[model samples]
Target: MTPAPAGLTCRLCGRADLRSVLDLGAAPPCQRFMTADQLDEPEPGLPLHLRLCADCLLLQIPPLLSPADNFTDYAYYSSFSSSWVAHARRFVERAARELLPADAFVVEVAANDGYLLQHVAARGIRCLGIEPSENCSDAARRRGVPVHTAFLDKATAERVRAEHGPADLVIANNVWAHVPDVVGFTRALATLVAEHGRISIEVHHALSLVRDAQFDTIYHEHFQYWTVLAAERALAVAGLRLVDVELLPTHGGSIRLWAVPAASDVPVSGAVARVRQLERTAGLDTPAGYQGLAPAVGQIRDGLLRLLLDARAAGQRVVGYGAAGKGQTLLNYAGVRPDLLAWIADKNPYKHGRYAPGTRIPVVDVDRIEQERPDLILVLPWNLREEITGQLSGVGRWGGRLVFAQPRLTVIDPGAAAIEGAA
Candidate 1:
C-alpha cells in the first residue's frame, strides 16, 4: 500500500500512527471566494482525506493551506447569523457572571467582528481580541473591541501576556478546529491564562457530526473534528484540566469546554464525566466509531444532486441561499456547477459579486432571489434552516420553496406542507 501523505501526524497527539477513515476527494479552500476576473483560469484543489489517530482517537485532516493563505483577509463575518450573535451575547452574559468579574481581563481568540467580545467589552471588562484576519480584526476594532491582528501561538501569547498581564479569561470559540498546530494553540492558551484563570474552548462535537451525518462540515479549514475524549487528552498534555463541558445547539451541535490549570484545586464537574462517558459509549475512541460517515456522506451527495437535476429537468429554477464554507464543500464534492446551481444569494456585501471557489457559482445579494424568484431556493447552511426558512418565508407568496440538503435533502414548508425530497 502507498504511504499516507507526509505530515499526516495527528494535530493534537503528534502521532504518525494514523489510519485513513474517509476521503471526500480533492476540494478547494473553503473560504477562497473568487472574483469574476479569476474564474476563467484553472482552479486548484487539494486532497481532503480524513485520518484517525489510534493513540488519541482524534479525527483530523492534514493542513493543506497555511494560516496566512486562509485567514489574512477572510470573507466570513461572525455576525451574519442573528442566532449566532445572540448565542455569543448569551455566552458573554454567563461568562461575565461565572468566569470573570468586571474590570478583569478577557481575551478572545479568532474573535471576528467583535461579535462576542463586544458584549464582554460592553460590561466594563478589559477585553482584547486576537484575530489573524485583517479585514475582520479591523471591523472588530471599529466596533470598539481592541484586537491584535496575529495568529495565537506561543510567541504571540507571550507578547499579549507581556502587554496586558495574564488574562483572567481566554476564549477560544470555534477556532481550535482551524489551528494547524492545535497543541501549540492549546499551549498558548495555557501561557496567556492566569494561574487561576479559565479557558473556554468551543468545538463542534465529533460524535454529533457522525450521529447526524453532518459530513459537509468537513472542510479543509477545519483541521480537526473533536471528541471530548480527544480534547481531554490534548488539554492534559498542555497542563490544563477539563473542568466542565456544556453541549450547545449552535453550529449544528457543539460543546463548550472549560479548562483550568492542572494544579488548580477546582473539582472536575460531573458534566465532564457525563460527556466523556457518552462519547465512549458511542464508541468514539475506537476505529469502529469512525466507520459510519462515508456511506451517509455518499447518500447525501447523491440525494442533493438528484434533487437539483430533477428540478432542472422539470423546468424549475434553483438558486442557493448562502455561499457558506460548508456549502462550498457540499457543492464541490457533489459535483455541482453553475449549470446546475444558477446563483447563490448571500447577505455579506464582501461575498456578493464574488464567485464560489470551485463551482464558480455567482454570489449575489438577496435581491437576486427577489428579482428572479426561482422556483426552489437551496439553503446551503442547513444548520440555520429554521432561521433561513423564516427569513425567506415570503417566498411562499410566489409559490417558491426552501430546501436543505444535510442529513438528506428535504423541502421545508412552514404551513404544515408535506416535506418533499428526491424519489
Candidate 2:
C-alpha cells in the first residue's frame, strides 16, 4: 500500500491544521481479502488514523490509497444483504412519489449492482448507474439496470450530462465518504443534476462515530465521516444547498441529505435545522466533541480481546459472522487470528475460499454454522445485528450464542434475551 503523503492537509479546505483524533496504527486495506496462495506473501499495511480539520471541521483520514486500489475488483455486493436491498427499494419508492416528476430521469453514483435503480426501472422510470467496478456493473446489467462502468469525475459527469441530459434525481447512497476528492466529487454531483433537480446523499454520521465509539467504521475505504455541519460546508463549495436531512439506522447510524443547486429557490426544510441542533447538542459542532474517542476505542479493544481469550480458555469454540470491511479493521486492530476466530461465515460466494487480509482467517459459506455448531458466533457487522440474529436463530437450538463486539461486547442467546454485556 502507498504511504500517506508527507505533510498531509485536510481534503476539504486544503489546510495543514489537521488534528489527530484517533489512531489504529497501520492496517491492511479493509476490503483486500487474500487468496490462500497469497497468505504467505508479504502484506502491505497503511496508517489508519482519523483527523479533524480545525478550519472546515471535517473528520477525515489521509488519502493513503486511491479509489482504484480498493474498488477495481470489489468483493462487496449490495444484493447480499437483504435488509439493505429493502432499504434501497423504500428510498426509490419515496423518491418516485415525492421528489420525482411524472417522467423523471434518475442517475445513481457508485450504484453497486443496481440495488436501487432496479426499483426505478421496474416503475418504468428512466435510470442509469455510474459504477467503478466492472464486476459489480455486470451484475447490474444482468438485472436490466443500465450502468456505465466509470468513476464519477468532472469530465465523466459532463459527458454523461451531454449524452442523457441532466438527471431529475441523482442518488449517491453511502458513497460521499468513499472518494478522496471531496469537493470535486460534490461538484460532479452538482454537474449531474438539472438546475431544478435534487441530489440525495447518504453518509455515516460522524456524531454516531464519536458518541458511540464506533472506531471500527474508520477504515481506508471511507475517506471522510460527515455530520450536517461539515456536509453543508462541502456542499456549498459545489454550489449545492443542503435543503433537508434525515437520520437513518443503516450503517450503525447515517444521515441522508437532500440538496439542490444554490440557484434554485427551494426553501430549506425544518429537518435540516433540527439535525443541526441535534449535532450541536451532541457536542459535534466543535473539535472538543472529538475528544475521548481514542480512550473509548481502547476500552472496546480490551473488552473484545478479553472475551475471545476467555472463550478460548474455557474450551469453547468461537467463530465469526460477516466477512465485512469493518470486521477486518476490528480484527486487525485487536490482533485476532485464526486460532481465536476459527473461520468466518459469509453469504457472499466471492469471499468463501479467500482469507481475511491481515489475520488470515478462513472465509467459508454460511452453511458451516449449521455443520459445526460453534459455541459462540461473533457478529462482526453489529449494524445488522437484528437481521443476522434472525438468520442464526436456529443456533439457539444447539446452545450456540451470538456475540457483538462493538459499542460494547454483548453476548446473547440466539432465541433469548441478551445474556451478557461488556466482558
Candidate 3:
C-alpha cells in the first residue's frame, strides 16, 4: 500500500518490490543510550517498521539512522551477560581450530567489549577487532584486543587491512542483518578477507522467524531478516560463496554460516543442501509465502491485545517482564502504556531503572515482580519465556499468571499450571 513507503526496499537486491508487514511507529534507536541529563532533552526517533520482498526472502525496514552515528557511540556491552562471554569464548576457541590459518590474523567486526577477541588473543592468535562503539572499543583495548573505533565500511575495511594486515578469519556475528548498505558491507567483507580466507556470519533467520510469528524482533536497528537463500543471492553478487552453514540454538533460532571467495572449489557442505531443501519446502521464494506473513503477524498482535483487554476487564493487574529491544518494539507496536503494564522488569542493571523505548514503560528489577505479585505478568521477551517462568515459579502463589506477548496472549495459571496458550 502507498508504494510500501520509500523507506521500504529490499536490503539485498535493492529491489523496490517491498510490502509492509509490520509497522512499529516512532521508536527511539534500540541501542542508543543517553546520560541521565540528556534524557530531559528531545531524543529523536523514527518509525520502527518492517517489510518483506516477494522476489527474495528478505524482510527489512527502512534505514532511518546511519550505523556510523548509532554504532560508533554504541552503548551496548556484549559481555554484560556472563553467558554471552562464555558463548564468545567457545566460538573463538572453535574458530581458531577450524578457520584460523596457522599464524594468519583474525578480525571481528562489531567486536563488542572484546568478548570474542579476548578469547582469540588468549590463544596467541594474531587478532584485531573493528568496533564502532568508542566506549566498547576502549573496553576491548583494555582487554588487550586492539580495536579500530569506526564503523566498517569499504574505506574502513581498506584501512583495517592496511593497518592490521588482511585477516585469515573474519567473524561478524549478529550484525549481518543490521546494516542498510548490505552491498557495500559485503563487498568490504570480500575486500578485507585474505586470499581463500573464511568469513563467518550469524544472523536471525527470516524463514524461521516468520514461520514462528516472532514479530517482536522487528525494530529500527535490525534492517533485515536474512535467510540462507537470500544471503546466497547477495553473496553471489559480491563474488563470494557460502562454503557451509549451521543452524544454532542461539537467539531463538539463528543461522551461523561460513563463506569464502567464489573461486574456491571446496565442496559445499551438506548443511547448505539441507537449508536449500528447507527453503523450498517453506516456499520462501514464492509470492504465496510472502502473502501469508502480514496476516499472521496481525493475528498475533490482535490476539494479544484482546487477551490484555480481557484481563483488564476482569480487574487483573498486569505487569511486563524483560525490557529487551524486542520488548520495546512489541510494546510500542501494541500501543501498550503504563496502564496496561504497571512496569517492566529486566535483569540488566543499565536498563532496570530506565523506560522501555517509546512506550516509556518503567523498568525495574525482578524483585519488583515478586513484590507486586500482579495477577498477570507479561513476558515481553517471548524468546526467554520458558527460562523466566521456571525461575519465577514462586510468584504465582498469589494467583499471579504468566503471559507471553508473542503468538497471541495466553496466560499460564497462577500456580504455574499449564493453561491456554502454553507454548
Candidate 4:
C-alpha cells in the first residue's frame, strides 16, 4: 500500500500509482548464459517484481536493465522451435492473403533470425527486419531477409520511415513485452505503419500469467505483461486504435492485437470488444485483479522444489529439457541447483556448451537425453509442453517420465495418458 518511489511511474501512462503484485525476490538476467570460464565469477542479480498501474492497468516491472544489456547479443532463435516457425509462416500467409496489397512493403520489429520475414520474402513480397542483435540480424540476412540492426525508437522509426516510406504492414511479435518504454514503443510502431496500413503486435496475455500462475515468465528481459486494456491505452497514445484482437495458444496464451491509425476509419472488429469484455470480466481492468498471484507463485515454487527433492531422494536422475528464459526464472527463483537437475538440453547450438544463467546447470545438446536417459525430464518451458513432449516421446521407451512444474506439478508418460500423481 505504500506509494511507489519517486520516478517509478507507469511506463504506459506515466502514473505513480504502481502497486506491487508479486515479487520473486532478485534474479540474475535470465538470458545471461555463462561460459564455463565465467561461471567462477560473480553473476549479478536484479529485482524481479511485478506491479500493476492503477491508472492504466498495465502489468509491468521496474526497468532494472536496459534493452541493450539484454538484447545486444541475444541467445534465443525463433527457428529452433519448429512449431513457432510454422506459426509465423501461417501468420505471414494469412496477412498476405487477407491484408496486404500486391506490392506491400512489410516491416517486422525484433525479427529474430528472419523467422517470420523469411516467409514474407518467400511470397516475393518486399520485407525488411529491424533487429537489435548483430548476430541475430546476420542470421536474418543469410536467410535473404533484409534487416536493419537497431532497436526501434522514435528516431529509428523516423529514419526507417524516411528511407523506405511508411510500411504497408508492421509486425511486432513477442517483442512488445520486452520493451521498457511502452508508450514510446507503441509510438514507434505507429510511426512505422502507413497512414492506412495495419500494425500487428503479439504479446503474452497477462490474464494467463495470473490465472495460471506463470510467474516463470516474469524476468528482467520482459519488462511488461500486457492485457487488452493496457494495450489499448498504449496504442491510443500513438494515435492508433485497437481494431481487432485474436487469442492464441502460443507462449501459454497470447493476444494478437491489430491496430490502425485513428483517422483511418477502419471498422473495429467485434473480437476487440469480445476480448475487452473478457479482460473486464476477469477484473484485469482494475488493480485488485492481480492480488492472487503472489500466493500462486509461492505454490509453484514449493511444488517444484518438493518434486525435485522427492525425485533426488528416490535416486532418480532428473534433467531439464529447454534452456529457455522461463526455465531460468523458474529454476533461479525456486533455488534449484545442479544437484536437483544435472543439466539442461536445448536444440540451439549457441547454448549447447553454455551454462544456465543463475542455476549454473550445464546446457547440453538434445542428444544427451538419449545418452543419459534420465529417470525424469523436467520440461521447463511448460508452454511448449506439447511440442517438447512430442520431441521427447521416445523417452517412454526407457521408462522416463516428463514433468511440468508450473500450474502444479503433473507427471506424464510420453507414450501414455498423463498420470497426475505419478511423480
In model 1, what is the error at residue 338, expressed in angstroms? 1.3
Colliding residue pairs in candidate 1: none
**Candidate 2 TM-score over all chains jointly:** 0.98
Which candidate ranks first by lDDT, i.e. highest? Answer: 2
Clashing pairs in 3: none
lDDT string, candidate 4, 1-423, tens digits: 345667798888888999889888888999899998998899998988788888888888999899999999999999999999999999998999899999899999999999999999989999899999999999999999999999999999999999999999999999999998878888999999999899999989998998898898899989999999888888998999999999999999999999999999899999988988888888788787778888888887887888899989999999999999999999998999999999999999999899998889999999999998999999988998889889999999989999998667899999885667732
lDDT of 4: 0.91
- Candidate 4 segments exceeding 4 Å error: 1-3
TM-score (all chains, Cα) for each model: 0.97, 0.98, 0.88, 0.98
Report the lDDT tens digits of candidate 1 across residue range 1-423: 123666667777677778877788998898888888998888778988888888888888888888888899999999999989998999889877777865699999999899999998788889999999999999999889999999999999999999999999999989989988888889999999999899999999998888888887889889899999989989998999999999998778999999999999989999998998888888787887878878888888888888899999999999999999989989999999988999999999999889999999999999988899899888999888778887897788788988888766788664445577643
Return the candidate ranking by lDDT, descending. 2, 4, 1, 3
Q: Residues 273-353, candidate 3, lDDT per residue (tens digit)?
A: 899788778877665565566678777778777877777888889898766777777777678888778888777666766
Q: State the TM-score for model 1.
A: 0.97
RMSD of each: 1.6, 2.2, 3.0, 1.2
lDDT of 3 at 43: 67
* Candidate 1: regions farther than 4 A off: 1-7, 415-418, 421-423
Candidate lDDT scores, in order, read: 0.88, 0.92, 0.78, 0.91
Runs in model 3 deviating more than 4 A are 1-11, 24-26, 32-45, 54-57, 370-375, 386-401, 407-423
